[model samples]
Target: MRNLTTSTFSLSAFLQRTQGKKVVLIYPWSNLKTQFLSSYLDQAKDGILYYRVPGETVNLVDWIDGMLNEFRTVLGDKFGKKTSAALAERIPAHIGEALASDLGAVVKSETILYLDDLDQINFDDEFNHWAQAFVSALPEKLQLVISARMLSRHPWDHMVASGDAVVIGVETRKSAMAFTVDTDDRPQLECYAFGRGNILLNGKPVTTWEGTLPRTLAFFLIDHPLVTRDEIFHAFWPDLSVKDATNVFHVTKRKVNERVTSRIDDDKQYELTQYTSGFYVASEKLVRHYDVQEFQEAVQQALVASDDRREQLLYQRAIDLYRAPFLQTVNQPWANDRRDELRRLYAVALTGMGRIFLRKGEMNRALGFLSRAAREAPEREDVHRDVIRLYLEFGMIHEARQQYDVMEQALSSSMNLQPTKDSRALLESIKARS
Candidate 1:
């Protein structure tokens, strides 16, 4: 009989048991799916039933069919001919007559159905039906296990509501650290928290700096922790003369030293170390935390995934990982460049998301997402191009023309280049429509 309560520890123990029972393991994100499946398979008994849901391409029927075929292939090798064939054929109707008769004949043992990447399956009415059917079809001695990112408002939620399902929550806190400027001028201590809110320092509740200019500078320094003071001064005072900016930097450095240098050990270097022309913070000791690293890793992973399933999962993971803009409260020149880089990457991610939506025939959502991306990165001609193309495809002439104008101005001003042939053609097409 299935237990109605599930925890990671309990599930781990349950999977290790030799007694065979029907088990379903549902995985959400694709990146972790294979790793989890391999672990489970290691503990699985011989003749264990295994089913893998393909990436987003396969529909429910195909997914089910594929599972039965795989079961047949694996079970046929182990359980001999008769049992393998029976199990494969009865897979589709496991809870009905076939499984019942087969179990009666073969001293019913455990059947494990591992469903990796359950999140790929859209949680619609049809999915709920399939889930219910699959669960009810299991034998009396069967144990089912489903794992996904979250079951909230999902078909799995309904399963939990009913007595047959057990729900378990895994609290995975992304690692993060907070930095406070000590009187000693060193990035002395680190703070950790569950999320991106205020970071605690030495058991005292500390809020992230809120003032506009100071916060901006702080973020810039954090983003390019190794950036030279000259680079930062240039970024902040781009319109000012270099000599003037250097003078300001010297005064500013003195003020920062007065305020933050007291806590630093005389032997230890300051947070902003002196380089020949300017200063830089060492990357190693910066008081940052886990979420930032997680997001950066996810972004790199997504970029590597390109257009594959892993890429989609990585994009989602990155989105979830990013809580706020790079040092949301900070505005210094160092911060601006980092913020710009992040915004650029964010626009690219949005464009990728729009393409996925477009492939799914979700035209409205695709256009909306692309439009927002374009707006966020108005200076990016590529982003505008994407918006224009999507709008043209959707027959939104006015919107397309507006994007063309924005693109034209942005390219001319920011890049000192005209729109490309493709962009011009798109603009002409919209103009013709108008």
Candidate 2:
């Protein structure tokens, strides 16, 4: 990996070498980062979607929306208001249809999607699904470059192994903390609690728990930080004596630590910490990460951001963190309430992001966020109302009325409720305008 064949990775050379392939996964050496690559891709005159996966968690819809913003940036006037609206309206289930329809005409001159900072991100079920469909359905001329800190369970290996992709590497000067797991490399620790449970350390799965106790302990620390032993005992083994629960807790914690840090140096391993309060928490300094923490932080940041643009971006960031329910398969007591709260917060973030876009005059983009919000929380009349208003604002009266009817039906059927007064007023205004 240290072999220095070139000073810098040449995109033109890479493309030329891998002829007729739409997807190219460039596994640059540990020294390589997005800073150098971003400059190279930004120079492309035709088109490019240079998205830096910023957080530990990313939602499929938010990821697609970020890409769409770039697609819109590159296509310019060709992707006008109506086209943008149409593209934004595409559901996550039909994102391929939306991308192909919007980009078919613009990808004639070698459009590229540079997904930077791949190691800092985790793919949820939606991301995995969209990525496969998006890549497979892409036009022959479109190219994709995924730059990650380390590789895990993404389909890049299959692409390379199947002779469908060309993997290139940069010369290693000093290895950065991140790299796409090479033939001999491995990720430090990657855990995904979004859909199904998956835990990887050193590129190996730690999903098979020694018992239910180990899984419970790991997830407890993930949701509740600095939890006291008493909290753990009461939550899981309340029926047992404190001494008994303490024994069980210590045993389970040790097993989880072993799984996470096996074959790794003690100094480098991110293990659980115990305080004088008998509270245990995961060390913050380690290479370990939690999707729930990432998602919550983004949402909190967005909530407090002062600038409109910053808030908009942060809100979208927060929305992206919620890919699935918190520890979807984990049915423990600690997981359930937090899962419901985050789900509610996710809906709020979606609604807020859409409203932000609406205020900025990006009607189509606003509609997209609102539409997703409505889908996420069908019972949230506020989201449905916003979608209807967005359609009316975009001069799509028919779409607005259609959405209103849908919302009305949903409210009546689901909750035995009717639209709120504000929503009824908005619909009346739309009718008046029509």
TM-score of each: 0.45, 0.55
TM-score, model 1 to reference: 0.45
What is the alpha-carbon lDDT for the whole of candidate 1?
Answer: 0.51
lDDT scores in order: 0.51, 0.63
Q: Model 1 over residues 1-434: C-alpha lDDT tens digits?
A: 11211211233543444234343332222223322333344354342443445565345555554654665564443323333354455443332334334333433555444454455566666556555665666566556565444333555655545545543211111111211111232142222211333332222333434333433343344445457655776677787788888776666655443333334444644443334335465333323333344455455545645354446555555554444566554445555565577666666667767767778788888787788678767787777887788788878888789889888988888878899988888877887888
RMSD of 1: 14.7
Query: Model 2, 32-100: lDDT tens per residue?
Result: 333234324335634565666666435555655565666566567456343345446655446755565
In terms of lDDT, the best-performing candidate is: 2
